[model samples]
Target chain A: MAERKRRRALLRMGAGISKSARVADRLFLPVVAGAALLTMLLTVFHRQIQEIVSPSPQPSGEQQGPRADVVAYTVDKVPISDPDSPVWDNIPHSRISLADQSIIKPLKLNVPAEPVKVKAAHDGEWIGFLLEWPDSKADTQAIKVKEFRDACAVMITSYPSPPEARFMGTANNPATILHWKADWQIDIEEGFQDLEKAFPNVSVDMYPLLKESIRDGKPPKTVDIPEFARVRLPGTWAGNPVSQLSKASPVEKIVAKGPATITTLPTQDAAGWGRWRDGVWRVVLAKKMKASDGQAGEMVIERGQTYSVAFTVWFGDGGDRGSRKNPSMLHTLYVE
Target chain B: MPKVYNWQIGREMDYWYEESRPRRQAAAVFDTNKCIACQTCTVACKTTWTSGKGQEYMYWNNVETKPWGSYPMGWDVNILKMLGPQRWSLEGERYVYRGKTIFEAAAQSERVLGYLPSDLDYAYPNRGEDETNEIVVEEKFYLRMPHDLWFFYLPRICNHCTYPACLASCPRLSIYKRPEDGIVLVDQARCRGYRECVQACPYKKVFYNHVTRISEKCVLCYPAVEKGIWPRCMRTCIGKIRMFGYLNTPEKADPENPLDFLVHVKKVGLPLLPQLGLEPNIYYIPPIHVGNINFLRMLFGPGVDQAIQTYNKAIAGRDLELVAALLLNVSTDRIMTKFKVIGSSEVAGYDENGHEVVRIPLKEPAVVRPFYDERLQVYRHNIT
Candidate 1:
């Protein structure tokens, strides 16, 4: 009887163990599968996230005007006057100053002299001036050009010789002849005399291109220098009723003669000039001007005719005397 | 009998070798007159391929105005001045650099200085006028004179060439052009940034990033290209001036095609300066403007007129049938079948005659959307 009871107990124990094992297997498989599915879903979502964050590989066809972000390749925010600005401080201004000294000696002036005036006038209206180079022992002409350029903060590119005067006539035109002789000097008295001979009707008053600075009396306030000058002639010449051609007026027709090729000036708003011949235009850069003021040559074109236009600009030598560098002037033509 | 057999075998081998070489495909043609300087290509390249650090100053692809503009300042003048009046050699197959004639001083200085004064000029690559100034000139005053004119912008990038100069110049041999796809690539891992590649490239497109200290260039967007997408610059060009596609197999490509005229004829016409010995793949359509004829002749060479004539014939001759046929392959639906195979037609819609019509691709695609997930990543596509 005892043996039979033991056998029953053993059978019951084995049955319980088997039942527990079956339950564990049933629970474990689904849990593991659930975990794996969660991981896979996470991976897929991760990939999607990556794609979203990254820039798209495809191009979008839209005609949005140039974005500001796209435009200015580099701002480089150079400080005009602030000394602390990174770009300003790093600039070779001091080296430029040294170079200035070498250029100044040829003008035959002393270290400190009375201030001279360098006036840029147009039609008797004074546009700008530089007064910084007072009694300095710098070359008068050199100082005149240097002070004027520095005051205006513009570039003055110089070619090797007279034949390569690359930038001469106007500030807005392209370069043509690469050279010019720098033999002529700007003398106020001479300039005034020349003006008297050219324009007899208008009183020719002379002013120095540079003036004394009010704040320091020694340094000049480098402000408001025009890139170009406009001169207007008097209405009377040789007893004839000279037409007061408006410097700002549009002309009906422009004729190109001699070496001068008449081309329309590239203007933002002006109607295009008409093409009179192959590779030729009616408008040309002004050569002679009225003595009262220096102005850019006026351009004229027919109202209804299509014309080719050219832009003209002058680049000066950086105030070097012995280098014999001359300005370069050229024109770039375009159809409007 | 044995000698005859040998001759036949030799002829067969020669023919096989010729056939085995990879053939030129449909080249990218840029009509400079049509280019409006929109700079869509620049931004497209920046955002797509070079958005990372050190790429701020790098323009793997850039557009510079001619006559008065240059990338890295004075690249064109410097190189032209260096090469100094190129001429062909006796072999007639190559043009020699003629080192003795070129400007060694300028070239040597540039190699050492790595920068020039014009590089720092603020006036370079000037943008359009401000709105305030625009209104003032337009409404307030009519001075009877116009102002604020701008120079033309010329878009540029790597020309995955037939004989890549960058590939030959690299000491590490990291730069390579794939034989299968014709895509030029620089293996970044192998590149040490010695900058020999930078000097070697006549185009000066390759640039060194101070941050990365490695030379980088336009990759041609290989990933996107593989997926049938055009490069970012080609797709996003605002002026619709750029066209990208693969050249067809030699058997399929038409030899009579006018566009192939320049490539096939070796020396009697205009070709890339041969001294560099790098056979550049990209071709330029010269700008046509009535200016100093002498200057134009000097810059473009004597064959310019003939090249222009051939180009005009290709573009305007035979009722423009040659150009139309080469540009697009027509089917019943007027859908471009040939260009579509190379991904150009897909981006540019098709014309009635199956020529691929162009539209400026500038904006970023709208399909991308953000989602938060367990991986802390942003998801681009919709979740299933």
Candidate 2:
């Protein structure tokens, strides 16, 4: 009887182990499924996941355009300087085709479909435009000719089509443009000599055109002295009339019409700021709507008036700059 | 594509496209005889530009063993196979290439001959030519073979051709030869990584950066050139076999200039492949009897034999200025627009503006080291 009881006990123990094993097998599938679901969630909300872990500021979602009648209004309570303001969240959006702008038709296939988000506000004296877009790269620096920087321009023109002007607007239409440059911002934040700092071993002598002396041969050994004045290559050097080397500004006022016709305005009142976060760029451009002495271009905004506005964007990594830029057709802007 | 004239082939050859000439251009020549395959030029170029992500396969400056080696692995062989055997016939002074150029190979809408090389194919560079198997005639004499293992280092860069196929192949018209320097460059803002330029370059020079998704190649170090400095490759050479200068027309070429003297006078430097009709600005001083003569002749056209003979004669005659100019003065930063032999001791180099760049002495400098002596307590020169 004792041996039989012992046998029965052993069988019960074995049965218990088998039952536990079956239970574990049943639970394994759910565990795996849960893990896979978590991974997928993490991938979808990667930006949010980063924020959750780090607990820093988070960028708001994409902005939505306002109704057709809702003109840009003056704001004192909401922040106008910050491009990431929630106030911009209520504004309308326009998705421009930068890819099709390619001169070569076949090249358009590679361009990504993206749109530019914009919002406008005024403090009576200062007019502010907040622009945002998705950019995989920040591209805040450019030192070499091949390296490019992200840039944005806002073209504002007077009503009634003053005269014939190209897309940039002509002297007759007189579009007052506020251009924001990421390169110029970086130049202010750090310096273009950063590349030199990175590649400290590779030193180069300044070019003859960069030198102040009127002679040529070997570059001067010392930094304080000049080696040569300028280079006389056998062709016409048509530099961008609006740009000059060894200088930088976050915002610039320019006017142009047609090719090779851009001229930088003398005004220094415009100011801009830009920041890239989580594959998106937020930019703010602010300038006085009225001229200092009360005389202004036809683009001067007035209450209850309608005006034309155009936009151009350069995706630094997308190879958009100069004439090769994503341009938008004229859009109506109500100055409320 | 329209029929146009190409003078680079030394004849009124037909080109499939019409392109306006650049005002002028910078040119180069490499003396392969002195090359040790150190790859300093390659390393310098990589460090300067191609050291970014997605540029791992790019070698703006490369050196491969001739008749045996090629970058993009088998680029020459592959193209040759596709084009078939190129035949040429001499008509009076001009020789015509019967084979199709990249332009001629393409359809009317296409600007150049384009073939997408598999990504795996770009992995290997400088994969040289296979050797001839030894013949066993009656006995085991492995030494005697007609096509033996003959090879020499052939360093290459962008030809910056008078008629660059890369420039023509770009549908966006972004690639341009600068009117100032004739340096062909793809505008950074205008390019959209189509790899058309990569497909068009017969030399397989232009590389596509997968990360940047754009085409990039040698810029000829224009930034430094504008400053009157030698390109990093020429400046940092282990062999001193490189020369950088401008190519002028026959009427405009400075007679005293080292470039003109070697190209037109001595006839020692020849273009790598003139039959392509691209009129490449880069020149090469053929390797000295080190590789297959017929193969070298095919590449450099008819100039191989004459170039070798002239180089030998110059070396034998102890022509100091020619030798000095060919070797260059490593100690100075002067660009030699022209060279002159001064007496028996030195060769003088001048810049475009009549400024003396360097004065390289034919004789070696004697070193006098000062060492302390225990007994004499006097310093003396130690000559090696």
Candidate 3:
């Protein structure tokens, strides 16, 4: 009688388990179909959903902007400071996201965000980078009051700290900054811009200091003006490198301990050129692999070594300048 | 951001840095009622400091005809538009600004709410010159106190404020305020030609040099001030409308100091746009003849009504101390720290060292000339 009762309970338990399993099997197809529909909708409205979710589009996971790593390929005697060199065609490019600089004083939080395509190459003697970014207008003139010039810079630190450290580095860990300005490129391509060049019809009675250069009842060229007259320009007289009219290269080497302490290195060891074509700026910045003796604030480049590199961009038409810029996070630059 | 007390606004306001007052604030009081707009101060400043290659458009000192005139094409109106509508409330005995300052109204990207002027904006340094509040073509035109149609000359210079917008807005910390005299200046060597100072200054005093590709402004003639002399603009004012002295805070107000007497005791002098929260060192005695109190209020703050009344009393010879203060303007090149009315006829000024710098008769003695000059045998057409 006991054995018969136990058999009856076991049979009831088996029946209940079978019924629930069958029900679950029946619901499985619809659940898969619903999940597929939800995924399709999400993929179709991905951009809209991102806009709703984030104030700024995050450049992550194979986005068109910059990635986390860049490899500097070894090449033999690629033309230094030439963005249009044919060698760039053979090299792979990495896209860099231009992040808004919202961490510092006089921040530029709203940037015309875009991806900057970059290619890095190095011979044994020199390391160079070619950066290409989009800008609707070519603003190469900063001589006017409201005009600011398009510019880009590359910062290379020792990569001694974590990636979360200051992009420009701190006082203890200094970074070497190579800045290329469009206005400086213009100065090299064309002659130095002066007040007379900006306003063709501007007239003045006389610049008494420039009397020695004035002739034929016409104003003298900026180059013709003597040193005595140039002293009147307090910036130039005070040895400010930014105010210097003549330049052998468009790029200037600057040393910085964070944003507030950016000073142009007296011995500039960088060279660059920038060209704006078809609403895009392609710039090449080059630096020596090793600094000459007594050359201060220069980063030494070496092969088979990794260095942390970052980028900063300024869109001139948007009035981007100084601490107002778009900066990127640190990326490992492998010099192979 | 730190909150600092702005005595001009009679309230605490947001500032980039902490409250740091100079040892002796270099101050000046301009009697707008007496200014003739001869451009003497402008020329003096031009020849003294800004006569250079890239400084053609710079005017450290400029006198504009008010109600429509601006040196940099709508500098005041443009900033005012950005600042939007502001209000000043009379709380107890002081007027408190209940509006946002340039620093407070700034966008997230900037330290101050500012706009960069175009090159053409400075092309017309004297645009709307001599223009009145409105067209004066009524058939029956009559002059009255606070006239139906009125205009006055407004001379401007760098205020060298206690909290300078230029100094606050500099990203690289190129601009500084001197600890000795509160004179704000741009260190040319450190400036990278960003022109942030040019955009930040509310008065549009900071100027950008096209040739040099850097920004420059009025230096307040520190070289002259270091030697206890007045700035070129103040000393060369032909109208005798400017008084240079060391001003103290209201709590440390010196009754005998000319700037303190005019600014604190009599309250005849008022700061330009005190709502901006710069605590500007320069003060202007409002024009009593201008009819629109609202217009005056916008430029000189809520103190215009009382300032005009006090100015009218001083002009009427009812206020001897105020009259003596005005008489001492341009009396000597030395910066006068103290002044006194000498009896009924004379006023005396003392320099920083307590030495009497100047003594001038309040009223010049006039002698009538004969109708015909006996020596030249000619009839005098004009006689004083």
Output the better candidate (2/3) by DockQ. Answer: 3
Point out where model 1 deviates above 4 Å. A1-336, B1-26, B88-153, B247-253, B256-276, B290-302, B311-319, B322-384
Docking class of 1: incorrect
CA error at residue B12 for candidate 2, angstroms: 3.3
Weakest ten-residue segment in model 1 chain A by summed lDDT:
A93-102
TM-score pick, better of 1 and 2: 2
Give lDDT tens digits, candidate 3, residues B22-121.
9999999998989999999999999887877678899989999998989888989999999999998989988889999999999876899898888778
- Tens-digit lDDT string for candidate 2 (A1-336): 999999999999999999999999999999999999999998878954553233221122433224221245667633534677776665654443332343322222244467676667776777777777788999864433235578888877765453233256765676778888886676555532233322233333442343342123222111222222111110001122222223345877766553334556656667778888999988888677775422335256675667666667778776555554675545556665
Q: What are the TM-scores, per candidate, against the unseen true structure?
A: 0.36, 0.53, 0.88
Q: Is candidate 1 or candidate 3 better by lDDT?
A: 3
Give lDDT tens digits, candidate 1, residues B1-384: 001011101111111011222334323445454576667777878766654423445677777665465666666567667555654233353223332221122232121112222323212432331112223444534332112322344567787755455664554455777765677777664553445566567666776532233467888787876555567777666665554555442234433332243233311123233233333455455444423333334444344455455655665543233343333311111222232222322223343255555432222245543465656666545743
Q: Name the better of 1 and 2 by lDDT.
A: 2
For A106-134, candidate 1 gives per-residue lDDT tens digits of 12122212111111111111111111121
iRMSD (1 decimal) for each model: 29.1, 10.6, 1.1
State, as a TM-score between 0 and 1, how close model 3 is to the true structure: 0.88
